[model samples]
Target: MTDTLERPVDAEPGRMNTRPAWLALFGAIAAFASAALIWICRAGDPSVHYVSQLGATGMPTAPLFNLALLLLAVAAVLVDRATIARGAGYVVGWPVATTLLVCGLCFGVASVITCSPGCPVPFTPGSLVQDFVHISFAVLGFVLAIVAMGQVAALRRRPWMRAASIITLVAVGATSLTGAMIALFKGDTVLGGNLEFTAATLAIAWFGVFGLQVFADHRTARRRAARSHE
Candidate 1:
């Protein structure tokens, strides 16, 4: 007797689903748009303030920034479904995907319940309970995303996936350390804020790269299938 392997019901062998790729692209665009809007709407040097401060209470960019977060959350949910539907060649497992979904939900919560000005953390003077809640949501979301990336990197199946994940993890980690130093020791605000922004941009770009990879896989599969028929 010979053994046959099972495949996802929604996916044809060797064919990559394009929905997740498209969703990720859309999410990245929305995220960048929100950041851009903040830069344009604000008066002071954006590099000196935390990114969250742009969306804090009474800021001109707050409304659109929050709106973008909501859009991203929606995109993330759709991406999760699309990823599962792809059924093959996806780097992360369902557990990791679920983690991403939770990360998206956390962003949504942060959008709805924004922090006060300066976006102070818990137990700080002039900090409201909602501020802590907002910060918690944002921190949890980013941490989960980093964790998911680490999990995918551990797979080491695709060279590009592994490299991208590792690079993003390192970039994010380095900036996070700077951010901590700024919080703890009054480090260079400009450097910390700029590094934080750059890390976030890199993460979003990497996600877009993943989407493009899926698209490439789809094209390759089509080419192979066509050659087989010929």
Candidate 2:
């Protein structure tokens, strides 16, 4: 007798299901759009960075931007769950999910706790705790996003997904780096802000592309299944 191997019902020989990718894309778009709106609304202020503006107490629109971040976080978690359901192992899925969840929670918390006066300035001896928490989440969320991108790139078997993962990694990296530079060295507000915005745009664009790819894959799979039935 010969030993037999079993494959998952939805598993394709060389491809992973892309449904999750689409979800992630949606989340990315929502987050990106929200961030863009926030930036545009605050562009007039010569003294404020996008990150700082997000939590600034005086900014009436801060809550809306924070809401966007929360939505993005939710989308990230959904993407992770979808990937797992499609048969990517526990190892690949959990970290992504956890990171996204953490990011989401952080955003949700930060949204309600608007920062005190002089927020973008480094937290000094008397800076409010809310400002510290807000900054922490902003930095950590981007860092985790970078990690999730790398994880997705490594675990996904599809060529397009892998490619998107790489692009996302680069975009997130640039965004994170620029954000850090702005925080640490207090770099040129205009240039750093622009670069951060560009990087974020690239990341969102990749999410949209990934979603399209996954949708295309879903269509292709359906066609193949139909042919096989015939």
Best by the lDDT measure: 1
Superposed on all Cα atoms, the candidates' RMSDs to the truth, in angstroms, are: 4.2, 5.4
State each model's CA lDDT, in order. 0.64, 0.58
Cα lDDT over the full model 2 = 0.58
Each candidate's clash count? 0, 0
TM-score for model 1? 0.79
Q: Single out the weakest 10-residue window by summed lDDT for candidate 1.
A: 1-10
Per-residue CA lDDT of model 1 for 33-93, tens digit only, reads 5445545544454533677777789876788767766655654554555455445434444
The C-alpha stretches of model 2 lying farther than 4 A from their native spots are: 1-29, 39-47, 89-95, 204-230
